[model samples]
Target: MYIKLLYSAIALVACTSARPQQLSLSLLPPAQQVFVQPAQQNNAIEPSINAINKPTNPIVVAAFQREALLPPHMQNSFYKNPKIAETLAQNSWFGPGEQHAVNRETEKIPREKIFIILKNAGLLPTP
Candidate 1:
């Protein structure tokens, strides 16, 4: 029984080790050639070009203006310094009692940038 098992294993090994016959490409039909046509240049002016380049929405323009005014902390809060915020609040023309209000406004600056980023990334729903 052991000899029969060994013979069967050897037969299995021999079958597995045999090289598979490869198909000849020469025997197959020739592939058809494809020619691509060049794109035609249009002389007509585009209707959307002006609209795409122009800032029609005042709200979006305001948002961009506010983005430009925002401090560096809004984009990179990892390097945020509390001392800078306090200093800005102190130097502002607001009264001493309004220092906290100034600080709060400074803190709020990043939220606009954060919301814009999140909305652009599709992580936050747009209003």
Candidate 2:
């Protein structure tokens, strides 16, 4: 009985292992194949460093349009009144007392004093 059970287990394992391995090669559809060709070669054609430096994407330009990442006061005004978007853009630094207002709101040390903190936190560019 023991020998029979051992032979059956071995046979089961052997039978399972003997099956042909599945080769999962997913062929892209004709449209996808054509679309992917250009994208695949996109990085291969290197542009001049100057060309690479320029922001070609409109989305990126639009994102940074406000400048200084919108500061906190501008964000409040923007949510309260959409018209403030235009107003904020005209100002050099988003809003009146924005620097001081933000400084007062946060408990964190002032940016000037937090140079080491910013560097250690990976927020500021390292020298």
Candidate 3:
């Protein structure tokens, strides 16, 4: 009972006698004058409504054209078996129309992994 009363008294004193510390407002050197940005100013910004001309895109071609391979002997040797060539072409990467597959593979790479790649590639400074 005495301990309880002592604790209660101490708590009451702590609560009642406690005063907020006064903050010392020491005057310092005046801050530099601010330059307000023009962009932040409330002004009527008219949107650009100019007619956009359709850009002429270059025609995309096959990965390997008939005449692309140089040296006739090498070309002939490579093209000896048409069936084998066709099968290999079907399974080969960097072939024509493989952009969709590349894009799918690209999506599989996590964004976090790109940071590590950039660090390894010396593109981004290590944090």
Tell me which of candidates 1 and 3 scores higher on lDDT. 1
lDDT of 3 by residue, 1-127 (tens): 5655554454334333222111112211113223232232222222222112322111111112222334455444554476875676457434556432212333333333433343344444554
Q: Residues 1-127, candidate 1, lDDT per residue (tens digit)?
A: 5655554454344333321111111212113222232232232112221222442333333333444445545644422366774565346444646432212222323333433333344443444
**Model 2, position 26: C-alpha lDDT score:** 28
> Candidate 2 on 9-45: residue-level lDDT in tens?
5433433332111111222222232212122222122
Which pairs of residues collide in model 1? none
- TM-score of every model versus the real structure: 0.18, 0.16, 0.20
Q: Which candidate should be chosen as best, given TM-score against the real structure?
A: 3
Better of 1 and 3 by TM-score: 3
**TM-score of the candidate numbered 3?**
0.20
lDDT ranking from best candidate downward: 1, 3, 2
Q: How high is the lDDT of residue 68 in model 2? A: 26
Error of 2 at 5 (Å): 58
**Model 2, stretches more than 4 Å misplaced?**
1-103
Q: What lDDT score goes with residue 34 in model 1?
A: 28
